[model samples]
Target: MTNYVGSCLCGAVTFEIEAEFESFYLCHCKHCQKDTGSAFAANLFSQTGKLIWCSGEDNISSFTLAGSQHQKSFCKDCGTALPNNHSSGILVVPAGCLDTDVAVIPTAHIFMSSKASWESNVVNIRKLEGLPE
Candidate 1:
């Protein structure tokens, strides 16, 4: 019965997810990289979660890859990723979209074969709190 609240970057859309996430995954699929414009996508999956759109529901947009099962939901204004409930009854939530922290750590990194070459050994890179001088 846990409730997780979230909103888009522009605050144009808000929502709530009620249920414990079964797993959190860092997906490195090419489709994920293209959609997120990043090395990987952090996502939470829940089989029985309930989604409640609290505001600006009409501002939400979704896209499904024509030849694949890949799909994504976002806010039309700022294009922040949002939760999507698939036809198979699974709920997918972008971890970054949550307003509060989630207790579950990422369960695994998936589709590693498609992981970007430059993304390798990223942990060895120097950490910076902000842009380097």
Candidate 2:
């Protein structure tokens, strides 16, 4: 199995994933949207991957919504999403945090019924390298 390295936004937390991700998913569940503050969360799933904290372990924090299975781990300093184990014992890594290339692309968008109305048309938006005037 290939191991991948990742880090938090502020570089305050570094970690490794030991195993190839079985699949990737874009979740549009309401909880996912709120947790990421975006249309959805791109998460890699691997039941066999072992999460290893390479550095700055103390800078990591996690939160689970009360009475819900929704949970997220992040860097306390920069609020960047980090990897965490799902309750189902699957390793869930936010795809964006990885500095290494992920060969596998997202399989599908789950919970699409809950997706935001403005989210689907993003592909049609004008591409820009920076904020538009």
Candidate 3:
């Protein structure tokens, strides 16, 4: 029964999700790493959520990998990831795109076998509030 609002980095696409997320996952699949250009993709999944496009819906584009369930939706302007409402009735929303603070934490890290080799002992890495001087 939680509602979440999100927009793209360029503010070209906006949407609202009206349902509680069933799970949150940090995905380390190669496809996710390549699309996000990061160690993993933080995603929130909901089976019954409804996606409401608030603005700039035309700016949203989607791509589904051939022969795979892997799909990505993004803002065509800034390339920021957005929600993917799959035909299978699962809605996958990128956690980073939400403007609202999420109460749900990651439920698990998936595809660990494909986790980046450089991510070893990442918890021990130095924490900085800003870019190094």
Candidate 4:
């Protein structure tokens, strides 16, 4: 397993994950769009229990949306979003936040039904109307 290290934009929070590259997905869900302020969110899904907060855990802030089961984590100082664990027992890491190069590229696009109208289409990906099962 490769060791991947990442930090918030302000360097106030740092974390590490010891795992091999897993699947990557692009989520275009409305909640993710608004939370990231982007057309979509690129996520690297890996097995849970491989992530470790090396430092600055106190600087990490969490927000759980109303009626949503997922909790998003970010750096309190720089607002850099961090990886979060879901109730399903998976670690969802933002691909953009990784300091190391991921071996696998995004293989699918999720929530295509809510994709931004102005967003450019990506080629060669399996587009799903909603989250892939």
**lDDT to native, each model:** 0.95, 0.91, 0.93, 0.84
Which residue segments of model 1 deviate by more than 4 Å?
Answer: none
What are the per-residue Cα lDDT tens digits for candidate 3 across 1-133?
A: 9888999998878888897999999999999999999999999999999999999999989999999989999999999999989867899999999999999989999999999999978899999999999
Worst-scoring 10-residue span by lDDT in model 3? 84-93
| Top lDDT hit | 1
- By lDDT, highest first, what's the ranking? 1, 3, 2, 4
Residues 76-130 of candidate 2 have per-residue lDDT tens digits of 8999999999898989999999988999988998999999999878999889899
Looking at model 3, residue 13 earns an lDDT score of 88
- Weakest 10 consecutive residues, lDDT, candidate 1? 81-90
- For each candidate, give its TM-score against the true structure: 0.97, 0.94, 0.97, 0.84
Evaluated against the true structure, the overall lDDT of model 2 is 0.91
User: Who is ahead in lDDT, 2 or 4?
Assistant: 2
On TM-score, who's better, 2 or 4?
A: 2
Candidate 1 residue lDDT tens string, 1-133: 7999999999999998998999999999999999999999999999999999999999999999998989999999999999999767899999999998899999999999999999988999999999999
Error of 4 at 3 (Å): 1.4
TM-score of 3: 0.97
User: lDDT tens digits, residues 6-117, model 4?
Assistant: 8889887889988765678898999989989999888888774388898899998889888886568899888898987767788888887788787888889999999998
Error of 2 at 116 (Å): 0.7
